[model samples]
Target: MNRVVRAAATVILLAILVPLLVLSSAAVGPAPRHWSGVSLSGWELPLVDARPRQEPGTVRAPHLDAVTDRLIARGDGGWQAVVPLHDGSVYVETTRLDPSLFAELGRDFGGDRVSVVYAPLAPQVSPDGGGGVPAQTLWQRTDPLVTWATLMFGFPWQLGAALLLTAVAYVVAARARRRRAAGTAAVPAG
Candidate 1:
């Protein structure tokens, strides 16, 4: 391929991928409610189960284990490390947990407990709240930049590194092709 063509293709590919990388990173980060949010700490709840939280009406795909599936799902992701609290179980979003920690939660799902520092993103009153009183609600990890950083290293970095390595490979292949062509041209021919 021509050098000009390859360079143009690389530029075009980057234009498409950079935005995708940014959008995806933001999508997987803490929900907007977690931005500048406060969290309740020193709370420990017995773990019930850990699984991907399927939104209503989403296509049902084959279920894979928790961590790898979430890593692949990226932006379209949700996880629940269910724990009993407030006289009922709350779907604690495990999106913020490190992959190792998330996997541990899954491993310990039914038989162990999890200590969490969480914030409720929204509260829905239990129907049995006795006259419209609010009940404990969905829990989310507090949105600190540091916690969000862990998620950044996942999809964005993986994609970025892959793109960069591809570019380097292209450059090496192009150079090797040029050297081979130059060598053939210098040889005596009948």
Candidate 2:
């Protein structure tokens, strides 16, 4: 078989195997879990309870527990919960963020409530907690496949890439050394 053909076949085989291995490894370990998105508007925020009875409601910054009161800034970046309170409703609004949390807001629910959007809350806060929770907030469900793929293939891919680079470097170095030795041998010995 030609060298190119062998290399191509190997690459194709690994490409298929890599994901399979990652998924298998992930399945064996405890899965990484992600929560749904939180609804917030300036000073007000809303949340959904996933227990049997289901607890949902809108909470404001001043009214929420300082320790558990957390919220995400809207404009850029991601959905980050800065601080989680011991037990209470807290909300935070952001302008610039690092990681995106839009999908999170769309997933993770326990009961009748699949998820809650800004059902009542507009960009601005309202006297009735429109921009926040409605005192009947309910969280939704998350995609387990995505959660697994993130941890499984993500770290493995990083490590695999690093190993591949190191292997290439060794090959190049060996070829260089061989060429240098051949050139030296071609010259007359001093």
Candidate 3:
């Protein structure tokens, strides 16, 4: 009803809304294009140099070895090497054949013979009913309700600071109004 209350409400609302809007906007950026008809069996490993490839030292994929075994056993006419990228995505290198082990798969190193499949190392339920695999997009990977819950209730320090700022603003405005009223009251009822 008073200016102080209005100002306090505005401050609190802005404090809450600004961060929410920013995070939501970031999360809502253009939806990633999903590859249709893609299955773990169909994905192939890309060709790299003869140097030994390394998985990321941190964040190992729990099911990666199993998936690799399946891929190798399937003999799906593609070479598959699972290499972890710097950004946490696993690049499964797929080629038609092993260059050294099985020379029959074709050794043409012109880059056209290799295909790279990208997915996060985190396990996720398959959206296409093929089986569980790492999710390809933020929308598919994260539970919406859980994310909202964390955003609303998590980060106590940030919430506390915003509340403190709101209270301070309210107190300052109220004190100023009171001082003005007291000054006017002393002025001979003018």
My TM-score estimates for the predictions, one after another, are 0.28, 0.25, 0.34
How many clashing pairs in candidate 1? 0
> How many residue pairs clash (N, CA or C atoms closer than 3 angstroms) in each of the candidate models, in the order given?
0, 38, 8
Off by over 4 Å in 2: 30-153, 157-190
Q: Candidate 1 — which residues are off by over 4 angstroms?
A: 1-4, 16-51, 54-155
Best by TM-score: 3
Q: Per-residue lDDT tens digits of candidate 1, residues 39-98?
A: 111222354222224344444222224433443344312233333333222234433434
Pairs of colliding residues, candidate 3:
44-93, 44-94, 45-93, 45-94, 46-93, 46-94, 78-95, 79-95
Residue-level error in angstroms, candidate 2, position 8: 0.4
Q: Rank the candidates by lDDT, best first.
A: 3, 1, 2
Model 3 spans with C-alpha error above 4 angstroms: 1-146
The best-first sequence of candidates by TM-score reads: 3, 1, 2
lDDT tens digits, residue span 1-190, model 3: 6768887878668556534542333234321111221112122113413222344464764545644555555443232256544434333444221222222211321112222332222343322353534434544343344334333333344345556766787799889999999998889943
Error of 3 at 58 (Å): 8.7
Candidate with the larger TM-score of 1 and 3: 3
Name the better of 1 and 2 by TM-score.
1
The better-scoring model by lDDT among 2 and 3 is 3
Q: Write the per-residue lDDT of candidate 2 for residues 12-103, one digit (tens) a residue.
A: 55555544443333334321121223322222134532111113443333433322222322332112233222233332332221113423
Instruction: Supply candidate 3's per-residue lDDT for 185.
Output: 88
Which 10-residue window in model 1 sums to the lowest lDDT?
Answer: 32-41
